[model samples]
Target: MASRLRTGSADMAPPISSGRGPVLWGCALAVLSIALGFGCASTSPARFPSGRALQLNVPYFPQQVGLCGPASLTSVLNYWREETSVEEVARAVYLPQLNGALGIDLTHFAQKKGMQAESYTGSLLDIKDHLARGIPLIAFLNLGGRVFPVGHFVVITGLDEAREEVIVHSGSEANKPIPYQTFIAAWEKTRYWTLQVLPPRPASL
Candidate 1:
C-alpha cells in the first residue's frame, strides 16, 4: 500500500504563488523499507554499449522545497512535447495540506492533460529499458537525511552503465548523475514508485 502523510487538514491554506518554494513538509504515515539488496545487480552489458551513456534533453525547473511535484511534472510533460508550467500543474494537483502530490494525483493530472501516464514499481533494468526506448520516467525519493525525512520527486533522463549511475533532473539540477544503488536506496523509501509519461498514441492507420 502507498504511504500517507497528513499536514493538518484539507482546509489548510492554499499553495503559495511565486518563488521556488521551500521543500515540502509532511508527516509520513508508514515506515519506508530499505531492505532491498543490490548484490549482483550490475548494469546489463548488452542493453547499454560499453562506455556509452544515454542522456536526453529533459528541460529543467528549479523547485521551491515543497514544489518538486509540479516542477518534476512540468519537466516530464515538456519532454513529451506538452507546453505546460509548474504553476498550472500545481493548481491541478497540489495539496496544500499534504504539501506534496501523491503519485496517483500526478498520474491523473497528466492523463487529464492528454498524456499517457502509468505508475508502477520496477527494477533499475526496467528504467534503463525505458530510457533505451526513448522514454523518461519520474521516481519518488526520500531526500531527507537521518535528521529529517523528506519526500521528493525527480525525472530520470539517462543512464551511464560505465559509472553505474542514472542521470536525473532533480529540482534545478539537470542531468545529475546518481549512483544506481544510491538511487535504488532512496527510491525504495517510496516503495520504488515510478511514473511513466508518454505522448498520446496516434490513431490507427
Candidate 2:
C-alpha cells in the first residue's frame, strides 16, 4: 500500500494559500522562533549556560503560575479572537480532570503568555525543523517503546546544535527538564507532537 501523507490538523485550516509548500513550514518555524525570543534575553552570556537550557524561575503549573496567568489569558484572547490565525490559551496548571489530557493546562498557560493557542499535526521531521530555530516545541511521547508515533505532551526547550539533539520539558513537578536523548526515545514511537509559537505581547511602557 502507498504511504499516506500526514497533515497537521492544528495549523491546516481553510482558505488555503497557493504559496503552500515545504518552504511555508520553514517560514512558520522561523516566525515561531522570533515570537518566542530564544536568544533575545538581556542576561549576560557568562550567566547563561553553555547549553540552551532556559532557566525557568517560574514554577510548574498549578503549583505556580509559571509564565503567565488568568489575566494574561484574557489579554491573549482579546487580541487573537478577531484574527483567523491560531490562538494561545494560557492558564494556571490544574490537576487533570476527567479529560485526562494534561496538555489542557499548558494550553491555558500559553494563552496567559499572550500566545496564539493552536496545535499542529505533523511528524518529528516537521518538529525538528521548527526546533532547529529558536522556537520551542511541545511533543507527545510513546512511553512504551519506539513506535511510529508517541502519546505524551512534552516541550523542546533547548537544542544541542553540535549533536543535533533537543531538550524537552515534560511538565514534571519533581523531575528536572528532560534531555534530548530521553525525549527522542519516547517521541520516536508515535512521531506525534504539538508545536506552537508564542508572539510577544504589546509593550506596557
Please tell me which predicted candidate would have the highest lDDT against the true structure. 1
Candidate 1 structure quality by residue, lDDT tens digits, 37-67: 2112122333544456888888898777667
Give RMSD (Å) of candidate 2 vs. truth.
13.0
- Cα distance off (Å), candidate 2, residue 94: 3.0
Model 2 agreement with the true structure over 1-205: per-residue lDDT tens digits: 0123222221111122232211111100111111111111121112222333332221122212222222222222333342321122322342323112333455545655567554444443444445444345554455553222223444444444334355544433422445445554554433333545456567899
Q: Supply the global lDDT for candidate 2.
A: 0.35
Candidate 2 wrong stretches, greater than 4 Å: 1-100, 145-152, 161-164, 171-182, 188-191, 200-205
- Taken over the whole model, the C-alpha lDDT of each candidate is 0.68, 0.35
10: Cα error in model 1, Å: 42
Q: Give the TM-score of each candidate.
A: 0.74, 0.40
